[model samples]
Target: MKKRWVLLVIVAFVAVGCAEPLTKTQKGAGIGTAIGAAAGAGLGQAIGRDTESTLIGAGIGAAVGALAGGSIGRYMDNQEATMRNQLAGVESASIQRNADMLAVTFKSDFWFDINSATLKPGAYTELQRVS
Candidate 1:
């Protein structure tokens, strides 16, 4: 039983940890799964009073929680894609998405003249499109 719990924990961590940081939906799912598993295990222990029931409850809860959280940041995903498409031809800017955050960076030299603080005339059109 202890070994099973340890394996389950390891698997959960592995599922949540990947080379790239998780998006909002993935993050939500991981959080939901952990919470659901704990709640289910507690309920199962209280109600069914058996190890088998606890395990079954945990599995069911995890699945439900994952499904519920799957679309948490879907709108952000669409917006990011749209922004990428709109900025496709621009060579002076770049976008980076990390989890629920979206960052857009523009080259200062492209938008400004040397060390001047004012944006170049051509930069307005690009900025307007972004807005």
Candidate 2:
């Protein structure tokens, strides 16, 4: 029974490790924005200001921030896809679309030189065209 429990625990740990981890930047931005918004609104209201106006301002600020962040995130994703495709050496690429964004992943060995960060000129040009 002890051996079985040990094996189960090992398997569970391995499964957890295999799961994708959130990047530190993502975690930091999400937590920071939430905390900042709450703090800003609370401070605004504590100064004998209009509560409704404070809340509305916070809501508008959050919406604009979210939109800007999403655009920047998509641009970064495109850059990553370009790099991956250049390194992948594949003939064609596939895109996975989410509700508001797309993920492009490729398969092929022709995309990059071994252990090299520099992309082929052709690959760079192609990626530019796609973007």
Candidate 3:
């Protein structure tokens, strides 16, 4: 009985966490859920030495972890929005978000010449403006 319930819960969580096309919040939540479940299961086993207690603890931990992870993802989303707005006018530049990191790519057309290692004259002004 207790074993079945624990297995069911674990399976359900794994299904959700393994789903594809996940948003940032969902990705974070999935990671959090896995970590929280492992920690909770360990603590439950240590304290109660029972499957039922493990299930309950895992459920609680998963919920808390999801909330925390979602909050962080939301913050990152907002930060990306702000960065996009700030860099909207940058020439030949593109912004890319990789999880918690932001990548900015500037084309060399405005910064350098083909097969040249020296910076173009306009590049100085552009760099100043960006800085």
lDDT of 2 by residue, 37-86 (tens): 66557655765489886786566555555555555555656666665656
Clashing pairs in 2: 86-111, 88-108, 89-108, 89-109, 89-110, 89-111, 90-108
| Cα-based TM-score, every candidate | 0.58, 0.40, 0.64
TM-score of model 1 (CA atoms): 0.58
Per-residue CA lDDT of candidate 1, range 37-65, in tens?
A: 88888888888999999998888888877
Report, for all candidates in order, the number of backbone clashes: 0, 7, 0
Number of the top-ranking candidate, with TM-score as the measure: 3
In model 3, which residue pairs have backbone atoms overlapping below 3 Å? none
Instruction: Identify the superior model by TM-score, candidate 1 or candidate 2.
Output: 1
| Cα lDDT over the full model 2 | 0.61
Candidate 2 local lDDT, residue 30: 57
Name model 1 segments beyond 4 Å from true: 1-27, 40-64
- When summed lDDT is taken over every stretch of 10 residues in candidate 3, the lowest stretch is 122-131
Please give the distance, in angstroms, between residue 124's alpha carbon in candidate 1 and its true position after superposition: 1.8
TM-score of 2: 0.40
